[model samples]
Target: MTKGLKPTRLIADSSPVMKVPTAPAHLSRDAKTEWRRVAPILVERCILTIGDLGILESYCSAIGLVREASKHLQTEGLVLENGKRNPAAGIMTTAQTVALRAASELGLTPVARSRSGMSAQADPDDDTDNPLAVR
Candidate 1:
């Protein structure tokens, strides 16, 4: 992931980790994969409480949509028979916007981490005084 220790790195703190719930059944398979991938990162960072699951789901779903739309655009080409832009391209752009916003909310983006007080040059494995660290 990142080069420095994230302020959300929970293992650096003595507090117990609170794992988020498993991927929701309503999520698509790709969304589930995303859920699994980020859930652990959030857990380790101690950034996700149970209440944040909805945002997480939204992020994953948007990412899934982006993936599906990208695939559609790839297979069908970026133009329709009438030469109009493919709708899937629009879908992908919208989903990507949604995912990026949701990821920022989840502190999954570099800017978000920086906003949470994680300096880009901070040392890895040195979580002392980390603003987001579990107490």
Candidate 2:
């Protein structure tokens, strides 16, 4: 038995499916939990459920949160027809536009990749005002 070494009997060398660690959790504990807590709220504000709102983008390869939102809007009949007047189209607010733009920029079309790479989740446990914290 060595001071810093695991006992040989306790070590089982085996290869399992890779596990991804969370982003470097250097943030203060309070801030870290607060960020995790706020993420769902932000997604709701963006008119998406937390699971569909890019939170699971890291795990899923299907259409991301933005595309889903667009689909939701379309299903709700908020789409403006070509050369047609729709009084309800005006109800599509500016926030929805921004979300759609972001989704488009992220390549949210059906052909989009479900998994791009292992990018770190934007941990907002530090400064909430940071642009990088934008979902």
Candidate 3:
């Protein structure tokens, strides 16, 4: 699907009969945690597969880097000697941008919601009384 296009149809009722991919062993603790948290949701939604593991790992790593950099920024402040902004702030910003970009590509960001034409109040059960419901 195109990056900014809304899907006009719902997913098939049949789930993909594929095994779930395991998280890479090289990921950091926090990255692994993130992988464990999001991988199943993507699999169940049929939006991801074993081939996409590398990209997902990269996204999770970027998230971990952002979190670590933010902690350093909180402790060390944003400026350094000679009134220069701390380099860690730049690292944090760059990491956050990369993470957001990865998430957007994976359709996990707020922009994806807009692109998919999703609304907070949308109801899946509203089809019950409609004649067009496929059963």
Candidate 4:
């Protein structure tokens, strides 16, 4: 037999329906709230699958960290003794960056596609269940 490239086989309906997993028990209350807020949107848009729960938890936890860091920075001003920047300023910056990166990765940012080059295919006007669907 001659060596040649094999033809690719396409499976029908290979994309699995998205399912939202329960918030992980280890997540803090704020993290759980963030998960509840974001998970459903990702699931409805079919961006996240049930198997991606771990990554989802990590993203939500990062958001919680950013929130906590922001609170600390707000309560305790941006500078400490000797006019040095508060350590919490650095922590807030790092946490905010981490959270933003995670959100962009998950397509939660408004301009995420411009940065990540991943486009969401779902059309807002394509809902079949709505009797008053806009054309």
Best by TM-score: 1
| Residue ranges of candidate 2 with Cα displaced over 4 Å | 1-38, 41-84, 91-96, 103-115, 121-135
Better of 2 and 3 by TM-score: 3
| Residue 10 miss distance in model 1 (angstroms) | 13
User: CA lDDT of 36 in candidate 1?
Assistant: 93
Q: lDDT of model 3 at residue 21?
A: 70
Off by over 4 Å in 3: 1-20, 114-135
Query: Of the candidates numbered 1 and 3, which has the greater lDDT value?
Result: 1
Compute each candidate's TM-score over C-alphas: 0.73, 0.20, 0.67, 0.66
Report the lDDT of model 4 for residue 28. Answer: 80
lDDT of 3 by residue, 51-119 (tens): 566778888898888878788888888886678998988887887888888787566776675553233
**13-118, model 1: which lDDT tens digit per residue?**
3443386577989998889999999999888776676667788999999999998998898899999999999999989999999999999878899888766344
**Alpha-carbon error at 65 in model 2, in Å?**
16
lDDT of 4 by residue, 58-91 (tens): 7898888778877887887788667999887777
In candidate 1, which residue ranges exceed 4 Å CA deviation? Answer: 1-17, 116-135
RMSD of 3: 6.0
**Tens-place lDDT digits, model 2, residues 20-132:** 32322544343344334444443332323323334333312122333444455667555345645443443334434553454443334333323332112333344544457
Which model is ahead, 1 or 2, in terms of TM-score? 1
lDDT of prediction 4? 0.69
lDDT against the true structure, each candidate: 0.80, 0.37, 0.69, 0.69
lDDT of 1 at 97: 96
Better of 2 and 4 by lDDT: 4
